[model samples]
Target chain A: MSISCDWPQAIIGVLLSQNVDLVAHVPDAGHAALIRLAEGHDQIDVVTLTSEEEGVGLLCGAWAGGRNGVLLMQSSGVGNCINALALPEICRIPFLTIVSMRGEWEEFVPWQIPMGLATPKVFEAMHVEVFRATEEQHVAETVDAAGDFAFTTRRSAAVLLSQQMLGAKQFKEG
Target chain B: MLERRTLVDRLLRHRPDNALTVSSLGSPTWDIASTGDNPLHFGFIGAMGQAAPFALGLAMAEPNKRVVLFAGDGELLMSLGILATIANKAPANLAIVSLDNESYGETGGQSTATAGPTDLEAVAKACGFSQTCTATSEEALDAVCDQVWTAKGPAFINLKIVCGPSPLVFPHSFDGATAMNRFRDAINKLGQTQGSYGRSNESEI
Candidate 1:
């Protein structure tokens, strides 16, 4: 069932409802609005990571301390996080990642395509279940489901926000 | 000038039993493990450069307890940006101690950037860490160790040591799941009796 909503707002609502205490990210175009929302949330501690891999370790720390966290990153950033993903899988720490897609539809940057195309497979290889939200109507529900799957099952889960939903980045001429 | 393991032991000596510690995937892990296996200590098997970030999260999670991170110079260099991230969050209960042996002792004594001239303490100071220091002598490290565990932090200390092999002491259970579950159990048990509940529900585990 499709529900009409602003995707970022809907996803942020789910994150808050899920009681995410920590939001760690290396921002991407698709996650910009969500990042702002997380930063503004009174209960959340927003951590800006220099590299995507650190987000993995940070989330594990949150779990160790008896808290929950969500990691936000772009498709290319997934490649950087591949190795560290082992932390969640091996330790059985619940983890949620909201990935904004690129290089799939109406793509501008060629470099992003390789990772975008490989992102799902990469996560699957790391044993993180992947959920996709290609349409705005599915964004909130998809995020809710992803968080449930991660936390309830004590497993790694990722929600891929489609490039179509985000609108491809436009290259501006200087 | 300082012996690596000796300094590591000294730093951890007299630390509170409840404090959480995370060791990088290198000699620091072995050194810390050599001191003893407390469920409070997390020995990172493979994730390099994540010690500080891990400790930062733990500190935020358990605001009342101190969290310490032990990492090698090479590991810290790989994720130098973490200093900025830690500074930005500025968790009061977190301390990061970098074992600057001037070389990648685990990979063979290849000189690291710190050997030539990369001062991690200076980098940490620039990143806005208020309690940043480089301890070259045993007495100096003793003084720094006191502040590391007790002082308001986001504190960072770089301990210069001679490069050498440390005897490997693996955590009894290499299974991350086993170690992690036990660690969480310890925290939960503490919460139940101490009247300071950790983030977990008693029944959850």
Candidate 2:
């Protein structure tokens, strides 16, 4: 799906509110817009990691340095991060995460379903909080709120964005 | 062998205020009981392997205070990369003590990476930890307590403890809301004395 241009603005606001100085992400088609937004921002140190778990480690390190950080990835990526999330849970280093949800929102692929169904349950199992974002207007507020909960609580929190909010991109053919 | 309770008693006795304790899901509940006013950070969240890294972060953020990571052998094996990272960074206030029961006690006592004679003490040394030891008896465990508590630069200790179920049980499955209020209250209290550990300015991109 093509992501909305406004998505970047909302993300910027969320980052600003959360005071996120470092971001670790594994590239996802749904989050390309958000990734671009992260890359263009000079203040945020964007680390493109090899795997979702790696991002978790990076964020853990960033948090230790007294910097707020987040991990951006797809629902499947959340699966990869289950054990990784334990790090934050155990250490009490609260950080915000933005998950590009799939499997539930007209997903084109089948593999995304397992993780989508498992995402909330997994977060629940790990003691991480999960929040879903359905619209552009909800993006900033949801992300900010998750960050607040993370910081105030000193635990991991997440915001899941549906594929619909990403919007559809236009294509031109000869 | 060191009874798990003895280890817990010592840890509780020595636990500093605002200290961070990272434990695997179900290793030792006795310690949790003694957590008291000190901030307790449970590591039952995601990667079993990343506890040390998380503890490292907390310790780095609060250099004056001690941060203890109560890890399991299974969990430690999962994110061994963290040891290398800890070695490189070498935060003096971080104390990582693995409850080395040689099994993944949480998932029905299955065998783990330390099942064989992998020698966690050797691993800690290889990871550049200067102070590394294994405690098989109560006296030994206590003997090392002072060093574990006061050692500078990323210390690792393996407690040869018997495995057991976690004492604390959540009403439902574990998640953010279950311990959120208590944890938040504890962190807030710590923040009052430690100052705000969170960053004020946001990242631009």
Candidate 3:
């Protein structure tokens, strides 16, 4: 049985505290709670995307307009963003993406493995700094640090919350 | 067939003073640059299929101000699903204008999905645009531009254009950071003048 965690609340608190005005995401179970927290918040505007890459454009526009935004997606979604990420990378728009990782350590899904294993290296090749958090206690602080580093340096950064931290996606019988 | 440059020029002339314009890469950016390099007009140096999503963000950020995305049909097709995302958010101040020249002009006149059977206007409607229409002639283009600027929208317009011998008018810089900062500066100035919504320079410092 999975007990609820406080990290989602802590992460949301830090994002709001950092003055992030927009939260753009594609639906992923790993980020569902945090997404709900942001959607319920009055200060932040949430833009749900059909695909992950759209978040890149959304955040670039936020940066252009002098607002900050975060992209929340799963590890597989990072591959969808390779080309679109160039918008912020080339433009030097400050960006933060908190990625909920899949396909490592007791993972049930096979298709997710390739991209999941490749996410950090892919982001690094695109010039986005990558940070990983495997422990629940490190979640909020890592997010805060990622936001600070990305925004202050005017660079794109990602914090990958590993499967161990997110807990395994439960397999259920139909 | 509608001429893209003339249509973009017409669109700009009728666009509101506070409306922020985001142009996609390639001919759309050049066409916007040809009009003038206003700080309010952000030209994508290289990002394709991003103008609409970018504009969507800007529209949400500046709810009081209007935001328009100008892109080629080919470019818009690359990220066709953004239309649904835009509809889901449904920012009242946002509008999208697709110049359907039927070919990717930047890539040497290769035909695109629009050239075959893809109807972006219909797709936008299916995605739930509050107002959606198309323009195949100059008169229709003028009429659509009117609705594009003045109407209550998350509007979508497919302005069909004749791909051609048009000269490219390059934007002064390919630097994305420069473009981003310039746009922010312009918005800040506007906010300060209007006494609303602008970030203070001190916080940035």
Candidate 4:
């Protein structure tokens, strides 16, 4: 059973503490609450992207322009951003992304499985540090640690919201 | 069609001190680099279709400075919807120039959609660009310069050019971290000098 709630509020607090002003995403139900919180914040400028890869470039641009940013996406969007990850990897720009998981616990869709399982390995292949948030208390601290580690080291980092914590998406059974 | 290197050199010669530049991968990157490099120029070494979105973000971040992207037709096609994304955001400081050579000039010149039925300028206009032009000649290019740089944007320029064999021109440095720092430092300095880092239009930094 999943007990993690208030993860969205906790994540937003982490972003604010790190002074992240730009937030980009391709809308996903997993991230809906967190996205709204960012949008509601006066200091955070929200960018809705056509694809996930665009967020990678946009955040790097914000960083180059002397601002901090975050990208929120789902596990499937990870496949769309593999090559674009080269920007941060090759350029060594500090990057942070929060990925909400799919295809775990009680997955209703089979298509989300491959990418969901491959997500961490894909990020690791690109040398981006990966951290997982499996418990309510760990979500904010995981993000805080990843953000600090990425910015301080000028390296890329990602925080994965586990299916158990996020509560697997429920679809009606016929 | 215009010669790309000649056209880039000419346009960049007039690039104001307050402007920022982003270049897409391959020929467009080489074209911008051939004109001579600057710390303000953030040329892409490998992010193929990302130049436009990156430039948009920069423009949004530093609305006081003009941020222009020089991209290739083939690369732009990979993410044409980014034009719509930029249009929606409607950053006044952003401009995108597609160096339309009608092919992937670096990869032995294979044809792109622009060679067939694609009209990028029309695409931009359809995507909500208020100022757009397809410059087929030097005269046409010259006519659009002022608006491309100074108009209420976001603007799009589709510059038609023949795919000529140009040498690989690298940016000032290949070090990503170093390049990023140089760009960040420059942006910070501009914000300080202009007193517009977190001006009224932008959220407080």
- Choose the strongest candidate by TM-score: 3
Q: Per-residue lDDT for A1-174 in model 1, tens only?
A: 455567787877787777676899998878998889878878778999988988988888878878888999999999998888888888888889999999899997898889999999999999999999988988889989998888877899999989987889987899
Model 2 agreement with the true structure over B31-89: per-residue lDDT tens digits: 55444433356444445455555565556556666677777778778767667666766
Candidate 4 C-alpha error for residue B72, in Å: 0.9
Arrange candidates by DockQ, descending.
1, 3, 4, 2
How far residue A117's Cα lies from its native spot in candidate 4, in Å, is: 0.8
What TM-score does chain B alone reach in each candidate, compared with the true chain B? 0.92, 0.81, 0.93, 0.92
Model 4 misplacement above 4 A: A1-5, A172-174, B191-205
* Interface root-mean-square deviation (Å) of every model: 2.3, 5.7, 2.5, 4.8
List the candidates ranked by lDDT, beginning with the highest.
3, 1, 4, 2
Give RMSD to native, each candidate.
2.3, 7.3, 2.4, 3.5
Predicted model 4 interface RMSD = 4.8
lDDT, candidate 3, A5-82, per-residue tens: 589988988887777868999889999999999889887788889999999988878667667889999999999999
> Between which residue pairs do clashes occur in model 4?
none
Candidate 2 segments exceeding 4 Å error: A1-17, A22-51, A54-67, A72-78, A82-95, A98-174, B34-50, B106-108, B163-178, B191-195, B198-205
- Give TM-scores of chain A for all candidates: 0.95, 0.90, 0.95, 0.94
Query: For model 1, what fraction of the real interface contacts is kept?
Result: 0.58
Lowest lDDT block of 10, candidate 1 chain B: B193-202
What are the TM-scores, per candidate, against the unseen true structure?
0.94, 0.61, 0.95, 0.93
Better of 2 and 4 by DockQ: 4
lDDT at residue B51 of model 1 (Cα atoms) = 71
What does candidate 2 score on TM?
0.61
